[model samples]
Target: MMKEISLEGKTALVTGGASGIGYAIASEMIDAGAEVVIVGRRADKLQEATEKLGDRCRWYQFDVTHVDEYDQLLNQVDEKSPVDILVNNAGINIKKDFFDFRAEEFDRIVETQAKAPFMLSQAVAERMKERKSGNIIFISSLATILGMHEIQAYTVCKSGVKGLARSLARDLGPYGIRVNSLNPGFVYTDMLEKTNLKTPERLKEIEEKTPLKGFTQAKDLGMAAVFLASDAARFITGIDLVVDGGISSSFLI
Candidate 1:
């Protein structure tokens, strides 16, 4: 097997990286020898993730919605070393009936998932465009393409992420900066476990719906993130890689 993926000297900044999928991505980059900085709003979780990822990983306490600080944050963290990879994985989901969904919930999800990533990409993109090399990846959800009973806000926001990736890839292609989106369907994270999804019936239902007959693991997502951020994906840009088990609800319906 030829080794085409490597993050030897790259630096990755992951938002909402204190736990769940974000932390997994940070850990993957660190394991691959990339300097990693995990950002989150909570200081305690940030500290915990930093400790878990060890030396190559550091923690930054900053709210992704705090639009005021994002402009100067990338430069502050990577003043000497340019950030080679950016993973905008921070997002919030409100599980509520569509009619029950308030305007505020919609705004929050859009702020964290769509706007913050857009602005932060712009922030790091300037440096990447200047250096003529970089990778930007967004972790989108399957709901972006389907109708869910709840989580309407999250779905809409992720839909924007996919759209952003498409436009950004075209806009940044000239500068040698790659922009892409990774759509992971029902990845089992610590947060998901908290949903009390341990029932055998629920598991079977999920497995049956998915062609692969199993849920996506967070570590799998981590590896995917690292690969997209690596030189192996150099020719790949503006593509959305779906990590689902091939149910293709979006296609069938």
Candidate 2:
């Protein structure tokens, strides 16, 4: 039997879904028979992605880090689900030396990575609790598992997101809404492209340390998202599903 991942009759809202890992996940969900909504700050990017995704995908424009707009954003999503499967995949990283970090910089990182995920999960959970079923998947990062320098704010926010998932699972489990976290290691996304590490030498460096011997493809994480959100993971919750290709398992540092 071809192992099928069916999300029939479910609604999924994926933030940052215009490109990269989020886009990959949205595509998978669309293939799995779910109605997918892609949310991103850039309307142009979202529209471009929507047009490509056809009828299975829709687009929304909103800043995940904007505190004042979150409630409104959630209201706008209005996913028809006591089963709203939300992929809190939108995030930003602020990399700066400890001494160079500013309050605004720290706030921006925390708001997008930690606060926004929490609020979105909470909003979805409230609806799920009413119907007593839903799934909240958070896209944390492998950065949290290590104390990487320079991006202290990003690392800390991701760590906090994992903690929130664990605690929320405990509180929400009784109501049957599962909450979990997924962390991906060095994926060559646009974010990586923007970094200085996009060189051939840097790619080789990651391959050597990564036990899989190469960086993860965006589609790899997409499969992870599909499984975690599907009924296959029904018995799982409060877990940090690390998709880092064993990079965190060795003494690679």
Candidate 3:
């Protein structure tokens, strides 16, 4: 008999949960019996998502890039329900030549992807330490290892996110908190469709390269997040869980 993975009685706060991968994570967690708070900058998107997610899900309109407002956001959420799981999934990617990358553009990416997660994790970890339990999941990218072109700043930020997860896992383990990261590969999201998969040939090329010979779905990463957040992964921490459909494992001859 197999034990079931459940998140009953837990409350998860997922950043960027209005759409794409974040929405999938929020939906999966809610399905796994968790009460979820979806955070995003757009009120309309958040409202639409929460409606689609049903009663177990709610929304908060806030920009994660505004680092100064993290505490305020946390306090508001904590007042309603303490966050048992934190998913740092909010990020932006600006593709440009390495030489053409401006300092300001790099800073913007870092502020959203790297610095926001760090600060939010720190704040949530402090609260978790009080209860001696919590879970933090960073949404990293497969580009960190695969090294995609024209996304130098994005790659750097995502690489830092993985490092943050490892370091936080070590630091927060004693407090009964688990820190981990998920590296998604070629997910068929609006972002990918708008950016990388503009041409069917390009899409086919990527799919062929992946050992699974397909694109990863957003729900795939969501289910992975649910497992990590549930008791099933109680003993797991400080690991980068690659949800790339075996892309990382293959090499062309």
Candidate 4:
């Protein structure tokens, strides 16, 4: 028999779930038999995604950076059903040289990536704590491991998110809540396609450098999120689940 990874009877709230990695993870959670709530700032995108995801999914439009709104959002969600799985996937990045980053840019990056996840996780964790069980999955990035040129703000926020996961895992483990970070490496999404990695030649560079000989698909990260949220990972916490096709581990000869 296949090892069970079912999330039957569970409810998941995925931030930034209208597109890209967030949508992928939400899809995976639905396939694993969980009810999913997709949270995004774009109402149209959220509506479209919810329709495509079918009956098991719903949408909530909210800007995750607004920390004060978290309680109200959580309360609304809790009324329907308490969130059993919280995916802290909402984030933003501005690629600029360290010297060029303005104070506003720095704050924007930190607010969206670091502060947003921290705030949402804390809000969800409170409900999870009351229930005495929940899963908190954070979406971090390879930037924390590899030194990519520019993107200092992205690097700082991603690193801070990973640290938040570790600290939460330690503090919340005793209460039966599991907190972990999923660090994705070079996943080719629309956002990524718009970046410097757009061209075929640039894509080929990533394939040549990655130990697995290719960049990760969004679904790969999705499936990883499913596993992390499932009971199969019951004993796992405070770990960085790197789903980067071994890119971060390999070095040039």
Candidate 5:
């Protein structure tokens, strides 16, 4: 690859990066010439991902929901290198009707999906403001646009993430930091396999509805993240980058 979107001298921190979409984004960041640190809760998984990603990639085992550890985690990464790009991609989802959802379940999902990003962005943005340069990207979801069934909390969290990015962009733009959210459609990954959409019939329905006629791949999401994090999108901020393969644009009615 030519790496037209070069991040040669940059360092990035991607949360939930042990597998799925996070891992792909980390790989892409490395391809763009940036050193990447992937954060996840599983030590073994993180180790495996790091080995696969090579020397340019590192991994941190931490759960974003542990709000108390946010400072310690940020301190550790900062000691090695001030992260120039922060991807708040850590998230969790529960498949249950709104009425069936327990309060605790909603709280847990929100802590990881919404609260973690808020705190991380606050910390990273403060440091970036001092240096006057940085990129913060959030991994939102298409559910925010077309409400999906049985994952009400997930939908809410993703929607909040987009709002968070817009507000952050307004607050941090003057300090030379850009904030954006990328909302992805149904992407085939381990996580997807665990969801109800894993059934052949459901998968077929999704593909039929998607104008692009296939599930979005992890690499596709990675390339989009790289573009937002690179100089190519320096002028873009507070925008929602939808990588949903035209699903959001379709209307069954």
Candidate 6:
């Protein structure tokens, strides 16, 4: 018999949970019986998501890039419920030629996608260590594996997230904390629509290239996350789970 997948007693903290992939993860976690705390920089988005997620959902409006404020945010959430899962899904992208990319722009992406997750994990892991259990998920990208153009900063930081997960998994394993990263491929989201899927040709190209001949939806990643966070994936750690519909394995003939 297959082990039942459930997060009945877990409380998850998902950054960037206001919309897109993050919001999908929050919704999926709630469906799997986990209370979700959605965090983002916008109050309006948080409020809207909270209402849609029902009573098991809560909202915290804070920028994850603000490293110093993580403790305060954690304290506030911990006061109500200790965080059992942390999804580092908040990210930003700047599309430009590598030659034209500025150092500051690279730093901004790194700070948000890479540094913020590291810092937040450190803070949450401390609490989990006390209890000897936790789960951490990093939202990486297939860009780290495939050669993608005009998103060097995003690719670099996302790659770094995988490295962070491996190292953290090793360090936290003894404490029963599992760290893993999910690499999504060509997911259809508001961000993707604005950046990568701007043109019909580009969209068609992506579909044709993917072995599954379609784009991965936000909920696909959400379900993958629920699997990783649940006891079903209890022994999984230090790995990058690719939920990209086989695109990573396909090649142009």
Best by TM-score: 6
- In angstroms, how far off is 5's CA in candidate 6? 0.9
Clashes of each: 0, 0, 0, 0, 0, 0
Candidate 5 has what TM-score? 0.96
For candidate 6, write residues 7-51 as lDDT tens digits. Answer: 888999999999999999999999999999999999999999899
With a 3 Å backbone cut-off (N, CA, C), the pairs that clash in candidate 5 are none
Model 3's alpha-carbon lDDT is: 0.90
Off by over 4 Å in 1: 1-3, 190-200, 249-253
Q: lDDT per residue, candidate 2, 1-253, as tens digits?
A: 1244688778899999999999999988888888898888999999999998889777779887665676666666674433369999998876667999999888877778888888877766877888888889998887787766577888888888889989999999999889999888889988766642648887788889998788888888888888888888888999999888899887984
Runs in model 6 lying further than 4 Å from the true structure: 1-3
Residue-level lDDT of model 3, residues 160-220, one tens digit each, is 9999899999989999999999888889888767656678888888888888788899999
Each prediction's whole-model lDDT (CA): 0.83, 0.83, 0.90, 0.89, 0.89, 0.92
* Deviating ranges (above 4 Å) for candidate 5: 1-4
The number of the candidate with the highest lDDT is: 6
lDDT, candidate 1, 164-204, per-residue tens: 99999999999999989998877777655544255778767
> What is the Cα-based lDDT of residue 142 in candidate 5?
82
Question: Worst lDDT window (10 residues) for model 6?
Answer: 1-10
What would the per-residue lDDT of candidate 5 be over residues 155-232, giving only the tens digit for each residue? 888999899899989999999999999988889887667765767998889889899898889999999999999988
CA displacement after TM-score superposition, residue 249 of candidate 2 (Å): 0.5
The TM-score values for the models, in the order shown, are 0.92, 0.93, 0.96, 0.96, 0.96, 0.97
Which regions of candidate 3 fall more than 4 Å away from where they truly are? Answer: 1-4
Candidate 4, residue 189: lDDT: 80
TM-score of model 4 (CA atoms): 0.96
**Candidate 1 or 5, higher lDDT?**
5
